[model samples]
Target: MPLIDKIAWLHLHDGRILSTRSRGKDAYYLPGGKREPGETDADTLLREIREELTVTLDPASLQLRGVFTAPAHGHAPDVLVQMTLYAATYTGQLQPAAEIEEIVWLSYRHRPQVSAVDQLIFDWLRELGELAE
Candidate 1:
């Protein structure tokens, strides 16, 4: 099976997590993207967040949240996505940028609207008492 590697940010507020929907996409996803060659996790996180959400993540504030693997959304059953999640403090207003078409805060009840890996993330956060029922 092929694995698609990605980095994601976990920004939670009032029992909800930040999520985005890209242009022309159905499922919502965390506000981050795949790592480019020669980029570390921090590098990818910084770049992707700024590009997608118009915010600059404070490098020193980046914290490892968790890593999750699931069947890639909209892909072959054999394809997998490994998402490395991080929690961090950021500057500037969060807005839809780049390919992002919408921004929303989602709780556990919104699980069906997100991607496969994101559903796993919602479950994890609920288990940790961080996501709302």
Candidate 2:
């Protein structure tokens, strides 16, 4: 099986979480991306958030939430993604950039519209009282 590593930001406000949909994709996902060569997790997340959401993440504020492994979203069954999650504050307004089509505020009820891994995350967040049920 091929292993794909990625990062996701857990940005929450009130009872909602920030999610994004790629320009030509069908499912919603937490805003983040893959790591570049020679980059640390903090470096990857900061750069990815800037590129995809037009916001700069404060590296010092990053908190490692969890590491999740799942069948890669939109990929073949043999592919799996190991996603590292971090929580941090960002500066600048969020805009859909690069391949992103839209930025959405998702509540627990919106789980069905997101990817399988995102659904697991949403459930986890809800159980942790970080999200509204």
- Model 2 lDDT tens row, 10-111: 999998999999988989999999999999999999999999999999999999999887788889999988889999998999999999999999999999
Let me know the TM-score candidate 2 reaches against the reference structure. 0.96
Q: What is the C-alpha lDDT of each candidate?
A: 0.96, 0.91
Which candidate ranks first by TM-score, i.e. highest?
1
TM-score of each: 0.99, 0.96
Query: Model 2 scores what on Cα lDDT?
Result: 0.91
Candidate 1 regions with alpha-carbon error over 4 angstroms: none
lDDT of 1: 0.96
